[model samples]
Target: MTVKVFLATATVALGLMAVPAFAEEAPAPAVTPANAAAPPSAADLLFEQPQMRNAAPGSTITYDYLRRSGIAKGPFGAPLQDTVTLKVEKPTVAEKGGAGTPSADARDIAVTMFSGLNRVPAGPFEDMTGNPIVSLFFENHLRALAKVLEANPRYLKLAIRRGLRERAAVTPVKVKVGDREVDGWQVVTRPFAGDPMTERMRGLDDLTYTVVTSPAVPGEIVSMEAASRSKDGGELLQEKLNYDPKAG
Candidate 1:
């Protein structure tokens, strides 16, 4: 089936967040896929950070989900709104006290979601609450992108991953947490800018994706967005997720 049709029928999960820690004091991890043994890259930090390490078992973090495409030649139809929650549970007895006991911060993480009419289940995302949900967010987006462009998902993922590791910008910013402001970092990346096949992407070659994270928040993610628009700004597709302060 075509990607559009598969998207309309198949159940896929997406997630994201934003916030930042001061870059001057501590930069995003520099480890990436190329060097699995090295420190994490910005991409690694964004998608693989130990976001829930500090949360006690039985705690939860929630996000507001949004997915929409413009009416003018947009790639998607209708808007999907939902609430996604990550629940942390205590590890089982064997995992807690035996020789195979996990690390001090180890905990069980699962997702509970309210997708309304969207009917998109958490799937792999269901068990991914330990790290930030942005991994699932971008994973689904990349899948959709590859399907829509009739490109290889593996290649597309690799390109984007490399772009995230090499071209992403990590900068300091401030975010509001309740009545106070906390330091955060805004990460931006344009993975397709250097793609040799840009012309075939139908204006998506310039798509921009951003992430914000902060150490002050319970979950480091503050917000995440992937968006693209036609040259004339008529057609567009935007997917984003933001931390809901009041709900958490």
Candidate 2:
């Protein structure tokens, strides 16, 4: 199985200052930056992260939907149509202090349905001939993961932990942010050599993801994208990820 992961975060420079929030705040205590957490091992990282909520049970978040078309296929492949829709849901604010302490915290969120479509040429018989449809699903998954990680680093952590425990592969990467570089990681999730697909489908190859960090906030994530193709263009389905924060 082949897997890929990518993540990024938005980093606004001083020149592009955002309007400051009006909320009152206490000064943060000064402290040395502790040892940066090491990237998880390929195996551990993919299988150990926490579950990403499909939708937070009691919270609401906004959604951003992005769609594009006419994506180019790999060399020797037919041109394909593609679309992606993502949902970002269930954002909750928390207290900044300890995990359970009543300090000030804001915006806990989750993402789902990062799906896309890519068309593959059908056989003369008009049925899909290979694995393009299956590959598209995972491809969209990876793309969504990459984008969400860019906007939220903590989400990346949770995704990695959950993904690894599920038998995923991951790697750390360095990406550019405005004028700086940040450390990021990627993860791939899939079944072992002989896992079964649902009744209607045959076995699937693999599902992989790469998560990166945004350069500016380091804490914020920016973008994600993925691509997939089968040896023979069979039937490609374009999927998209749509993030809707308002869905609690």
Q: What's each prediction's TM-score?
A: 0.74, 0.34
**Candidate 2 — which residues are off by over 4 angstroms?**
1-38, 41-101, 108-163, 191-193, 198-204, 214-219, 225-228, 233-248
Task: Give the winner by lDDT.
Answer: 1
Compose the digit string of candidate 1's lDDT tens values, residues 1-248.
Answer: 00111111111111111122111111122211121133335755575566656667777877777766553333454556677787766656453455565555555667665555654465322223245366557776776677666776766776667667788877766776556677767778888896877767766777788877777766678777887776666435667777776764
Model 1: CA > 4 A from native: 1-41, 71-74, 96-99, 113-117, 123-132
Indicate the worst ten consecutive residues by lDDT in candidate 2: 11-20
Q: What C-alpha RMSD separates each model from the true structure?
A: 10.4, 18.9
The top-ranked prediction according to TM-score is 1
